[model samples]
Target: MRVISLQPSGDLTLSTDAVKPSPRPNHILVRVRAFAVNRQDLKIGPSVKDAGVECVGSVEDAGGVKGLRVGATVAVLSFGEGGLWKDYCLVPAKCVIPLQVSPATPGSPLDPATWAKLAAIPLTFLTAFGILDNLDLRKHDRLLIRGGTSSIGLTIASVAKALGAVVATTTRDPTKAPNLSENGADFVILEREGGIKDDVRMMFASKETFTSTDELSTPALSTTRINDSAGADKCVDLLGVNTVQDSLLALKGPGGICCLAGSLGGSGSTSFNPIKDIPSGVYLTTFAVDRVDMGKVPLQEIVDRVLERGEYRLNLDRIFGLEDLDKVKDYVEGNKARGKVVVVLPNEL
Candidate 1:
């Protein structure tokens, strides 16, 4: 088994060995197939004190556990320093999902890569669902998908579009328009162009049946010149940089809800006076699946939605092997990946 560990200096030390990980009575054993190198993985940037959590890995070998079997394919979510790059990984029985899926590409059996992609789908999809479904998203609801091209953005856009809500996803570059539009995004804007708030108003206006303002059942649009600026009822901020503050400025007053699934932007430290842009009646929250699934219902409803309608196509931006693990920290932190950057285990798929 092999795993990549990071040092404070930003160098990667790839260590290998066959060590058996202990699974609780409620645990499942998974064989590593394919894993992802996510933006969250770079937080520990070879220079940070203790890079909080590292996001990576997917499918696994089923070690004869209660619900998981030796040949059963499964995907595992690593929120913190989860070790899955090695040949085998262990997940709490509850955290493990029983995904009955065929290979994404026909006639192909579920390998680590396939399983890894499947596994990668859960966490992001879950985060998006919480924002849209759990929060009661509406078709007419406007949305701001910040960090538009991130692995996080891809999943959020797919689900939001399915719900019939017009989506305005923000990307760092304009080159992503064709790809983002194909994924169901109605409009794509660069993060700084007053993205969601500005573009959304124009799009809604263009689709308007009549030019008269009296015809709109909705309130006046709220914006710079519009007096009542139009804003997202729901905003998904994957970049955590000054999140609370930035999102507060983007959210519609009185009813908007902001869900912070990742702190990629930086922490919501309220760098400045929080009251300035903070609107009344807007609810701000940060949550994890463990907390959401507290007990009433198993995640069967959400998981089923993904299995039946889930599309796992990522723009395979780049592929790296064991020897290339060292370059990942630099590549990811530099924000160079065009889409989902994945690393395949050196062994055959």
Candidate 2:
């Protein structure tokens, strides 16, 4: 099998001599078609190791798994052991969601372009959906998605909007606002040079002051109250400690939930005084995609929605081949793409 492994020099090396992975009793062996790059891949440092987290492929062997069959198209979320960037990879049966590839039906076909799009969804969509699910999002609720231009951020905004929530997203670049808005953000808050917290507060203040009755009635923002603060019903904080305080401050008081789903900014510890940082009655929670229960993910519904829409709306910033592993690493490390970067594998060895 061909695999992309991290070398001792901290660079990814594609080698065709890699040993093929076999399926466990409860796992399936998949012949990967395409896989998406994620920020987590950067942490797989200087070691000779297989290092991908998600892919879309076909089941080469079911390994006695009852429901899965050979040759079935599947999307694999490699949480237990992160390595799907190869010709053959082992995936737990529970993490393998069979996809329908019929355009005449309620799903997408496994064409090259569609496979690339499907590759972009698993980890990103699952993480976003898990966060929103944890927050117990409701119709007409106002959601503030911090770091809205990132892949998961964009997916959260789109999924939340599809679920009838009025989505407000934050981006450091004002130029990305129109794109975010087109992707389902009702409001785009530009992070000011030095005062992101104040800028967020000001944006919410404007929402409170000028938001219309029709807007409030259109499953956008109803008269929802949590304590006395007039702000977002819930916030999806992807920037971690760097922006969590501002996220709490932008919520609609005590009943609001802030889901800390990522540390895209930095993972360093921060000092925060809860009494001063968190708003009264508000709740803070953390979500990790790998920690989420596979049984609880609405995989079928998510796929159905994507197919029904007839297109994958999440942006594909770039698609690289297996040979470009080093370039992919550099591009991701440099944060050069606003959306998901995928690696499409050749179907044959």
Best by lDDT: 2
lDDT of 1 by residue, 217-237 (tens): 445642223233356677777
Total backbone collisions for each predicted model = 18, 1
Instruction: Score each candidate by Cα lDDT.
Output: 0.61, 0.79
* Segments of candidate 1 deviating more than 4 angstroms: 22-25, 45-65, 104-108, 111-113, 193-229, 241-243, 272-276, 289-316
Worst 10 residues of 1 by lDDT: 48-57
How much does candidate 1 score in TM-score?
0.74
Deviation (Å) of 298 in candidate 2: 2.0
